[model samples]
Target: MDRIRKIFLVSINNIRKWATNPRIYVLFILITMFLWSSIRPILSFSKEMGIRVTPWVFPHLASSFVGQLILMLGVVLLFCDAPFIDEGQPYFLIRSGRYTWGMGQVFYIMMGMTIYLLIVNFISILILMPNIFLSTGWGKILGTLAENHGESVNEIEYISKKILLSYTPLKAFVLSFILEWCAGTALALLMFVINICLNRAAGATIASLIILLDYAIYSNFPSVKFFYFSPVSLSKLILIDSKGISNYPSNEYAYIFFIITIIVLSIISVLSVRRKDIQVQPAV
Candidate 1:
């Protein structure tokens, strides 16, 4: 119990240190502003067309191309300087058990990513407040699609409408938020593992590339889409309707895969850190 408390306190201190860093907060706000600006035009167009928008629309937009670009960049920037890269690591490496230190780093990444998502999502809700309406089901929004059966709608719009119709507005919001959190956690853990094996820059670059590649492959090859492990896959898994309307894999399976991946990556990171020689210079 005492050891756990000590580790918790150490992790909290690390989180506080990170919280004091201006760059992370600055990047977070900038990303939020960029997302808001990008979505403003869409909201305006929706209003012009007399389309009833819901709060759930923002998550769909945030997961779009522009939104994904900003999100991936923000994540890379925010975590590119993980604790493993800090200078004078030998001194601190022995101060705490490697496992504890690794756990602290994990906690730090989780907290940072949570804050980033919350801020971005909060800003999105605020921007769409005027058009935001809580609906019990998708019947309200899908009416737009029904009215324009001949019009060609994009896959994103189709999926978003299906999600909104299948789930209540509040349920959609909570599910979307949970999916984002899970994806962020998985991504952060993966990057940390990469940082353990390679340098921070390489980790960040490769992590971002993995996400892009996953998206590209999933977009082009619908059959093998489920094989890739990326935030895009996680998001898509969450957006799948209960009736298998999207023809995607079940959420239960995807979630289980995410859990397994996180556990495997976390164990690998901890083991690597434990065996790593502290005599070498820091990567930072």
Candidate 2:
């Protein structure tokens, strides 16, 4: 118990120092602005139509555009090196045993991912404050069927059906927030594991490219959507088919996959960090 408390204190201190960096705030603002841009048109349309929009709409749209690609890359860049490559790492490890240090990194990565998503989603909700409201129901616009009969017909119908059949707005939003945080943590762990074997920049690049490639392959061959690393599958699980529904993997399966992936990646990360040599130069 005492050892655990010590590790928690050390991890919290590390998080505090990390939180003080201006780049973190800059990234938050940049991401918030980018997400707002994507949602601005939808909010404008909702206003023009004089319809009340669900609070979840902004987060749903933001998650779709942000996608697994950006989420994985953002986490990789934000946390890959900070955990193990700092010049202060040796001192930290000496003060807090290897296991504690490893656990601290895990805690930091998980907390950072959660906080980052919370801030992004909070900003999105704030942007649509006028329209945001709690409801166990779908918004009128989303509940309505798409009138278009061309290439978008199938996509629109799928999304409408999924939203109508799935959990309530607030329930869905909460589930999505939790699931996306888990998925992001798994992705961050994977990056950290890679960074243990490679430099931070290379680790981030390779991990990001791996996700992008998975997305590309999943796009071309929908049958492969059940693959564990498929970003499309993760997005489906996180966004609840906000963009559109796919035929390969169901929402249930995607959620299960993320849970399993999280467990697996977390184990790998902790084991790797425990055995890793903390010799890298401090991050610039």
Clashing pairs in 1: 138-165
Please provide, for model 2 over 1-284, each residue's C-alpha lDDT reduced to its tens digit, 9 standing for 90 to 100.
98788668766766776566666666677776776765555456567667766666532442453444555566665775644556556777788787777888888777788788887777767887776555667776455431221122233222234444556777666766766677677767777788786767777676677667655665676565445456434554333443435544556766787778877877777788778776756653
Which predicted model would earn the best lDDT?
A: 2
Candidate 2: regions farther than 4 A off: 62-66, 82-84, 144-161, 224-232, 238-247
lDDT of 1: 0.62
* TM-score versus the correct structure, for each prediction: 0.78, 0.82
Q: Give lDDT: candidate 1, residue 31.
A: 79
How big is the positional error of residue 80 in model 2, measured in Å on the Cα after superposition? 3.2
- lDDT against true structure, model 2: 0.63
- How many clashing residue pairs are found in candidate 1? 1
lDDT of each: 0.62, 0.63
Candidate 1: minimum summed lDDT over ten consecutive residues — where?
150-159
lDDT (tens digit, per residue) of candidate 1 on 13-85:
6556556668767886787678666556545645766776555554555445556667767777777765444
